[model samples]
Target chain A: MFDDKFLPQFEQIAGYIHDGGAVAIQQILHAGRYGGIDLGYCVQPSVVPQTLPHFRQPREVSKEQIKAMITQHAEAAKRAIKAGFDGTEITSFMGYLLANFNSKFTNRRTDEYGGSVENRGRFMRELIYAIKEAQGDDHPLIVRLNGAELMDAHGGNTEDECFELMKMAGDAGVDMISVTVGWQEAPESSIGRDIPPGHWNRLAVRAKQLLPNIPIAFGVRLPNPVMANQNIADGEFDYWEVCRPLLAEPELLHKAAEDRLDEAKHCLGCMNCLSRLFRDLPYLCTNNPTLGHEVEPEYHITPAVVKKKVMIIGAGPSGIECAIAATKRGHDVTIYEKSNSIGGSLVGYAAYDMANKEDLRSQISYYKTMLDKLGIKVNLNTDVNPKLMRSILHQYDVAVVAAGAGVDTRGLPIPEQEGVLVTAADVAGGKVKVGQKVVVLGGGKIGLTLAEGLSQTGREVTVVEKEKRIAGDVIPTWKWRHTSWVEQLKIKTLTLSKPIKIGASGVTIVNEKGEETFLQADTVIAASPRRPNQELFQEFEFMVDELHGIGDALVPRGLLQAIHEGYRLGVRI
Target chain B: MVSTADEMFLDTEGWQAILDRRQEIFTDMLPGASLGILPKKNFDSPVGTMLTWVRQADRMEVAYQSFTGFENTSVDLLMVVDDETLEYLHSQAQDNAFNEMKEQIRNGNVLLYVMKTLDELLDLGYEELIEVLKIPVLGACR
Candidate 1:
């Protein structure tokens, strides 16, 4: 914005957007406290030291610099208009520079820019006025403000203060108000999957009520277009401001428009994308494997050079995903599962998941719909093995082992006992029953999830782990949730401990201190030490021309790797 | 007034002093603003050593409870420490203690916070505190 030399680049971008017949709004983002990524210091309204160590040290912006910043913003808006943009937007969301001025947590100015709510909001109001004036009335200007900063503990803006800022924006004659939620350093989750969809609709409703004349756009945690459309009909907000959901499935709107939403890949709200972005890596989605590979020729599904009969073992997320992708590429795909249903370990896990189970179940739903629409044959209750493959030896040109991993019963301390010991999978799959007192071995995500769910159901559950901490295998985003649920549900966790013996009455556990304690348990469940089902690789080595292993069958891992490996294998095959 | 983070948190007397000074703020807050502190001997291992402070009308009642892990305890806030942080506080190294505590807070071990206003504490619900306070109860995806 300081130089006109970048005008050609903006022009090219705007031209590309215009060619698509889409109205492009140039968002001049000044990531205030979060800026100066490569520099030693970031400029904030006040010198508030960073709560998150990832951010740079803050340097207070001078009054003179504040004036220059406003001028720069105005000039940026003008340059955007010159570049053929339909409108311009200024963002104060996510504790940015504008947010720094508005939030009491950062703004400590004693001059005209601080003290009262009106004074704190003066910067945003002025920026809105200046950008509107610079871009002219013909071009609309949108201001993105936080409906709730979720920073009250740190003396950040209250809900009323946030509403006051929105009101200020509306009174200043801004075209639209894009209400967002939470700051980067905020302790609570605003958009995570644990938060139910439509949880923040009340914020949107309040924003609309406060500013009836200004168009309000909001989509914080509200993912489904069907829900967004209903919210619009109910007057929750004027437009559904979506970004991450589109990142998960770029054709989300098109699928919604075509009424083929069941086929649309839903954003799981796993935060893998944001997690990567926070760590300075390229964005990747857990469910949508081709998210960052838009331009890669290998990622796109092209018609197979030679259509082959592809047999995928295990109708889990991995196998189902492969079946769908391969079928789309003109291959005759069929999925074989040992269970009565399609979803493998995921179905079991989702049943006990403390987080949004619907999001996990939605992936399975999408896969089922795609498989049906593509006419992919699914043979459930058919376990693929050497004997089974011999019957159909020449049936499939390629054999994909997506059979997934299972608990290593061999690693358990106690030998299996009827009605006394059950696998976590069996317990989750409802194939095996449990007693009143339950002892779960291995305190990773799987163990903790099972324990939490059982405890919720009034079963006295205890988790035993050899590690120093639980949730070691859980993703960083949901680690705290697991820990919290375990605490809230009063689930007992014995970290740095492992079960030594299992009996009819209970299990004996040994702690790190070389002391043994007896924890009475009616059932001891094994939930850890997952081993890949790689025996088929050796058995079917001479059976098929191509015997490839994917997902948990290759290595015991999580959903992201399983989906990615499946899709990648499907495209190449 | 205590001079440093170490001086303020090293002994029971220091904690009692803090509670006394901040009595008005604590008393004004809603009940159940109890804070739990778990100091681990090492970061990688679990150590059973715990401290709790419950807010009262006049002062905060500080006590040492049986070292139960966070799951069995109910508190508005909890602070868990790493080995180095505990060493710094024990050694009475003021600057080192403060800096290490800040780093630990970022690392999700120390859940240190300073509530500014009574309204802020009163208005925030239990779930909101779990979500918004940097208490490190760990749940957020994107």
Candidate 2:
């Protein structure tokens, strides 16, 4: 319904909001990367170039430029008013253009637009005036802001200044204000990666205390509806802006109303959707494949396509999704699992706490339910190849390549004592035994998760990262959570350090200062951080009439990316 | 003197000529209007620039410049020329627009796609600029 509608389009949605008098938030879309980063549409950038002035790199506006932008916002508001929007929100949330201006790291200017807090909010101040002028003085104009900067360079922790800015927004005619921590520069850190649940929720409490008269809200990816309700009960926050979770499931609001709490599709704190956003690709969910492709005819499949014969190979998440997708298309999809049962590598992953296991469990459940609905055949104890799988190609019109990864134990060329070394997969599968102490080699997501699991098991663990930071490739949000938990569990993470050698007694590592220290470890897990599973992929390399590859077959990364690529390829067909 | 970065060359005059050539190529496609033509007057300057509303199938205006070898067509067109003939002409434009705008994004020139449009709008001449701009919206007609 909100198609190509400009700022004034809010009025249409506002009708529903106003009937209930629900708040009208101006969810401003800011390209934190601006034109530099490919936002959803490449054509928008092409619409106006930088020389066109409007196409300017959303740079920290000069007092003059800021005034002009504020005027445009005011004009947008005036149009919205004409369109019947009840109130105006000069959007500052979700790391939009204004947030970029607010960013301490990205905004390096020494002028009034940058530096100290008062000077920093110069642009925002002008914008509030524009909104006030547009609203004719008596409508709510709220400011969405960061309670903290997730990155170090941007000064998000200027608590007193944040308080001062809240006060300024209130006094300058801002009707309400909401505070969320983490900047768009590092959005992963903003949602839940760097901070704990209700992390920035407390910031709103502080802001509310500072400006007691004005209402304040906090944003987080809280999957637990009960916790959200309880936090409101506990007076910790005013309102919650559920971004990622809502992206994970848009029906969340209506479903919770029916008290069908378990039915609510939760956000896994995975950033697949946002990562796709960086490349202007479609949104992907760990569980739902219907997101972003809502416009397609087969967006939500009907019973008509439920009768065709379909074959899905490999029991991995991608293969499962393909089978599920094929089944939903009204095809009688049959899943071939090489292993005894379903839930490939995900079995080891789902063995973790529900949050870590949420995606895997829910998706497996979804596929199982779908397969049940269609009466599709699932054959376990089945391995497939070019010759053996030839019958499947002849049988089903479509074949999916979802064979889970082959064991890749590429480790350091350095030697290790017998029984002292165990790959992460072996440990994950519980086939290899670890002694009282352990040293994990790789710091990738898999390696890190394994280390965290070991630490939770009360094993003494030391993680040595060759890089300066342990979780660079991991989404900022997950990195923040995992890193914080690992720290709390007292897992020793040695950054900028390399394992010198591993002996039966322990492992020796050279620190950044070139100082060699031997840590006591009965076992060393060689999670050599993985490369693509070539052996499995090579088996089907040009054997079939049609072939497509995705997931770790592309690269060994987090489940989020694999989920995104899988969902994208699903809708493509 | 608007030079491209490093050994990257920028011939502003040549670019001006290439742009001028494109304007000629698409002259008939442009809107046309009458203007106070001060013969051989300055064109490079933003001031000598004037936009007039007019009536014509194609927008038209002509001028000569000191920095330009001949004149310009459009910056947007230069970044995405229709043919090798256009490329040769663009290369002749001394590739000044390359730094300001490019046919492609390599380093960090996502702006080229639209920057070229700006150059086209300017090279579109001033006489018929307003006529083209008066986009008759259905609602606005009321």
Candidate 3:
């Protein structure tokens, strides 16, 4: 309910809030033109996505205009205060205009609010003090501030800034500061990437070090409570702001309290929750269907009408989810996974990022729990063929296929030298060995992640993307790390470079100018691009009968698409 | 990721169909409308265009949409107002910040923005928002 489509809905809800509960108005001036992309998305991106070198909001903000914006902010606050909101959370994280004004990287103008750190922080500082005075101290004022965005491009903001802002807000009669990262253009990297688990803790610890008494909420992507509690145990952050995960599984807190954490089915950080933010789609979870369904429980979760027999084949995300839902509906269930372990491709992809892998494993545990609760039997390491399916067809009322797609390792058409090509899965599985000097041909997510790992391993790596920028489809936060891996590894990136030939010596490439050049490498990885081996056709009968096929089995795609299909199929079936 | 079609002419099942099929998705938005969806006539290729690298999408719920203060009939507008980054980046390729995006937009590799309201068009200081409807659709994979 954050877009234009929500305004009418807002008024209707605003009427209800006014009728009873209080409402707090949080307005973020996402300045898209300041530093990089001026991405209307990032409150204030490091580099405006659209660079207007000559255009600067600070320089353009005349005293009168500044007064106008401030007055507007105050008026909105005053209106909300009048509308019965207990207080407001001044959102500055994700580098909004106020946040950008605080960022030295984004603000570079010869104006009162653009030079020193104090000047850069003036807007957020002024707004807090102004609104605090307007609403009075102890009115429950909160500022969502960033300790760091984790992006190199967005000239990092640190715990020092958080501590400074805490004191300033205290002086200005502010109440709390919720700390977050990923404010810059590259979101995942803003806080932490999918690599190294609990990466944001260090930054959070730095903030707490400076402001011991102030409350700080950590906004990293946590798929489950174990990770959240672990972070709290580490004392890196004081509060855990469950936004996306909450969208993924709204019953998280309740489920955790009931000792049913696995049943909660954590968020995958696929960025779908925020996707709906663009169109007012309920912040959704690829696993949990009940999210954002406060009004209608039927749409999310339906209670069982009567116990029935159910059978599921191909135990990937979709298979597990189906088993869970069916068992919850009082049906006796059985699961068939071709792999030895219950987690299919996830077992391989689980190694992608520690935190993300943990999330995936946590969901896997949920499948185990739900299946066990419903007395669902699982036949592991047994492939489900048509004959086996027919033999059991009389025993089960419904059949679900989670059988995943085939793993496609399309070799490079170019000549291969020793140790030059590897499947993305093999790379993630740590099978691919990168030599001292490396060149990754494919620049997709796997290629990028693999490239990052190789670069982090301290190899001289060069990433040749057939496309312009690598990892274009990763979430903002992760996107940051994906690219940073390239920078942090000091990997040489050749965009708009096409690979014409590959050999043991290295790779032959034509740059954007179409000039042929050979990149010398000790080894070459041909993961430049690959396809999924969706097995939907094999499950055609199951889909026709029980109505679903999920994961790579159906589309032969990545986790994002696979998980989405799995969850949606859960509802349809 | 680039995909080729076979069953329905796609490497991945019609991702466009999957995306387009979300109209019935029950979510927070009561009547979720896909803004990036464009008329088939808008594209040179029937297949959807890919907007891989551009960043940040601003989701705005229009409080009001009017021309000279006269209101439009439909619910104001649910628009994803892109900052002039694409336009700005397209205009300045030589500049350091735009070196990456300039090549994409020029080559016609653009994710189209659906202009639902009159102000969305006017906000860009352009004559017609309706005309820009002939662009690529804006969306996310998951």
Candidate 4:
């Protein structure tokens, strides 16, 4: 973006996109407070220090620098147009450099570039004018502004002020406005799965109301294409700015067009993409196995040369995913589940999930739909044990042990009574009954999710973890949410503590400090220290011509690992 | 090791080191503005052991004194950091240390309170104080 040297590359990209019959718009963003990673200093209208350690310290931008920046933006826009881009977009979203100039919290300059909303927006106005002049009238320019900064606590722009800025952009002759929500430093959740889809439609509605003449595009946390279409028809916004949804399913729009959205995989809103970006890693999607490895030939489904019959054990995310993939590759595939339903441990996990249960449930629905469409056979309530494998002895050429992880209760203190101890899976799946007082062993995501869910129902629940901190196994992005939910739900947590003995009335626990405590619990649930169901691999090894283990069967982990392993196995097999 | 005109005795080297490393925080303060750093141990109280700055006739003076109670002086903001976090800051390189400190602030391990309102500052949670006070706490991960 700094030089025209990359114009050849831009031309290639623009040509490639145009060759696909799509218009290309190059988005030029300057990470203001979030910039200067290598230089150790960012440029802003005022000397505002960074709020996050991930960003650099700020240096005040003089009037001369501001003028130079405006010209630089204009030149960049010209370069983009010359390279064959149909349009250009300059964003102030997520507290970028343009946002730093516009925000009252960041822009403390005493000069004309700071102060009142009008003066604060002058930089944007000048940039728009210059870029429009440089790119000419034929090319459109889209300005992305925050509809809600969600930074009210820090004295950031109010919703009213955000709209006022929108009006300024509209008046400045911008062709369209893409309204976004929240800053990276915003304390609350914006796009995470905890936030329900269509939660931010009000912002779009307000923007549409404020600027009737201007085209408004918004898709913050709104992943469903059908809902987006309805919102557009309802006049909430002129266009739907889809992003992460497409990341999960690149054929999202195409599926919607063919009325096959039910077949399209939905974004779980897990924030794994942003989470990876924060860690300076490549973007990875939880639901999309082929997201980052698109170019890898092994990651994609290809017609199998042998057309072998594949037998997949346990109809969870892993097994189902492998079934669908193998079926697509022209292999005869069938899934065997001991449970009455197709979704394995996920069925139980989704039931107790606090954040957007539909998101997790949709994964199962997607699997079910894809399995049916792919003509894969699924035998529910059929356990694939050694006996079953022996009976089916040469029936299937390949046996896949996707029989996902289970709670390892072997380490749990022996219960005085027969039914005092139960697996977290039993409790989550509603197979076991719980009493008023419950103590959950292990403070990982499963234990926490169950503890929080039980506490919400007015059950007295306490989580005892052997580790010093809970959520050691949870993803970095979601660790905060679990902690917050536990606090808000008033669920008691005992870290650095482990259950020593279990009784019918209560459980005996010991802390790290050698202090013993008796916690009254009607049921002690073992939720962690899960061992993979690797028994199938050994059991089916001699029986089947080819036997392999994928997902938690290989090693216990979460949905991401399960799907990735499943797809990789399916593709290669 | 080095002497200045207004050197004063402080309780811990941590407090002195904090002031020495982050003195620009004081220079950006208004003449009347005062901020108090409250250790996590003594968070129940309204006041903390003082590491403050006073603007004199021409020069800004850095003072490290004992807690004098909230009513005795006008304090604009209160920043609370756990004793462990302060020790953590001392154990790392200057740049790496502040980055961790800023991250601690972001995580609410370091808490900030606007003294006048007695309300927890939510601008940047704990780290926003750096922005509000114009203190260039530096370091980038890249």
lDDT of 2 by residue, A13-92 (tens): 67767786465555434343244332322111011212221122332245565566667777766666666665667655
Q: Give the CAPRI rating of model 1.
A: incorrect
Q: What's model 1's lDDT at A476? A: 73
DockQ order of candidates, best first? 1, 4, 2, 3
Q: What is the DockQ of each candidate?
A: 0.09, 0.05, 0.04, 0.05
Fnat of each prediction?
0.14, 0.10, 0.04, 0.00
Tens digit of per-residue lDDT, candidate 3, span A6-98: 455545655775664434444434343332223222223232222111122222345566666666676666555554556777776654567
Lowest summed lDDT window (length 10), candidate 4 chain B: B133-142
Model 3 DockQ vs. reference:
0.04
- lDDT score for candidate 1 against the true structure: 0.80
Model 1: CA > 4 A from native: A1-5, B1-142
Indicate the worst ten consecutive residues by lDDT in candidate 3 chain A: A50-59
Candidate 1 lDDT over A15-123, as tens digits, reads 9889977888999988898889678578988766555545666778889999999999999999999989989988887889999999998898789999899999999
Model 4 misplaced regions, further than 4 Å: B1-142
Q: Write the per-residue lDDT of candidate 4 for residues A157-272, one digit (tens) a residue.
A: 99999999999999999999999998877767888889888999999999999899999999999999999999999999999999999999999998999999889998988888
lDDT of 3 by residue, B63-123 (tens): 2122211011122122221234333432332343222332333233333222232234334
Full ranking by TM-score: 4, 1, 3, 2
